[model samples]
Target: MQTTSHILMIRPVQFGFNAQTAVNNAFQQVNNETGVQEKAQQEFDRFVALLRGHGVDVTVIDDTPQPHTPDSIFPNNWISFHHDGSVILYPMFAENRRLERKPHIIGKIAEQFRIGRTTDLSDFEAKNLYLEGTGSMVLDRTHKVAYACLSPRTHPEVLKAFADATGYETVEFHAADAQGVAIYHTNVLMCIGDDYAVICLDAIPSKEERKYVEEKLKGSRKTVIAITLDQMNHFAGNMLQVQSLRGRKLLVMSTQAFSSLTPGQITELSSFNPIVHAPLDVIEKNGGGSARCMMAEIHLPGKG
Candidate 1:
């Protein structure tokens, strides 16, 4: 299936900006420290409520205050659940971020979902190589393709290992912002949906690379919805298509991202699925991740 009804979200206990991720995540901005955690928690709750209101089944796990993982809210980075009853653990770049991957959380999920073998790629972190789960690669599950932009957080060898293990074809490319700095995560620059793809072609400066990516998407029968660099800065490409309980398709993103969309882009995207957005200013600014990053899609079958 292209979309999943189940999603996993980590509730922040000590939610704040992290210097570790900010090294490469230009989207993050450190603002006043006053009430940041409260504001972020409020935004997180509202986002969860908004998703639930739209019929999305969300599994929310509260972060432990003891470990102090500031970026724990974005669970898609360290772990991903698969449809074939497989759970894949990824190698995170940040030392603190690695703490977000709790074995107990997977144990809790296993009670409801039939989890089979686990692919542990975390060992690569010892060699200074990393691939931060969905953050490193935007997956077109239906086509079995993993589109990744090379970066420090996304290593080619680790990506190839993931592709080999999952039987996914890797489409690698280099993407950067206007300043020529590499984008921290592929999820920030592109999203692959069931029948459509939202991407910032401008980020892939090389004509040959852009053409390769475009051709791959076209060949996969995806309607490309190209977002400009400015739009990408507003998180326009960070969208996720999910199935509601009633099987309705909903595209979830931040309100800022939604507002950045052109009328034509909105019309074309809405033609495929209804758009669902919530205010995420605090989270986006501090976390460097928006709605798509916050959600880890659960594709595992039920224990029954």
Candidate 2:
């Protein structure tokens, strides 16, 4: 299935502007250090409540202060859960972000889900070759396709390793913002849903690459809803489609992302699924990630 009802969220323990990640992430903006963590926690709580009200099963885990991981709120960067019971761990770009993956977290999740073989790619971090889990690649699970925008954080070698482990064919391309700076993550430029794709086609400077991406989306029978570069900067392209406990399809995103959409885009998206959005300015301004980044879908089957 393309979407899952189970979602994993790491509650902020030390959420704030991460200097290490800001070096490459263009979306990050430095804010007042004082009380930023508190505000972020409040936002996180409200976001979780909003999703829960929509019938999505969210597992909230508290981040430990021992490792002092400031970017730990975005758990999707460290690991991904597949329906095949395969748990794949990826090497994160920021050193501190790598510490987000803890043995205890895995054990906690194991209590509810049956985990199959584990594929650890953190060893690539030593060589400075990183691929930050789903952040590095926006996956089309239904079609077994991984769409990735190449950047310093997303290396070809690491992507090949992921493809080898999961048998997912990779469609690689380069995307950049209006100012010509490469986008740090693919999710910031495009999102692959079950029946539709939200993407900033203009971000791909090369006409050929842009056309290739469009072709793939069309070939996969996905209705393409394009966003402009301006909307992309608002994190409008970082939406995720999820299944509700009642078997409803829901498109999840931040209020910022929702507001940036055109009426047509929203209507087109609504035709396929109802939208679920929450205010995430505090998290987005400091952490450089929105609703999608905060969620790591749990595709593993429950052990009954």
lDDT of each: 0.93, 0.93
What's model 1's lDDT at 202? 96
Minimal lDDT window, size 10, model 1: 29-38
Backbone collisions counted per model: 0, 0
**TM-score versus the correct structure, for each prediction:** 0.99, 0.99
**How much lDDT does candidate 1 score?**
0.93
Worst 10 residues of 2 by lDDT: 30-39
lDDT of candidate 1 over 248-275, digit per residue (tens) = 9999999999999989999999999999
Task: Write model 2 residue lDDT over 266-304, tens digit each, in one string.
Answer: 888999999999999989999888889999999999999
Candidate 2 global lDDT: 0.93
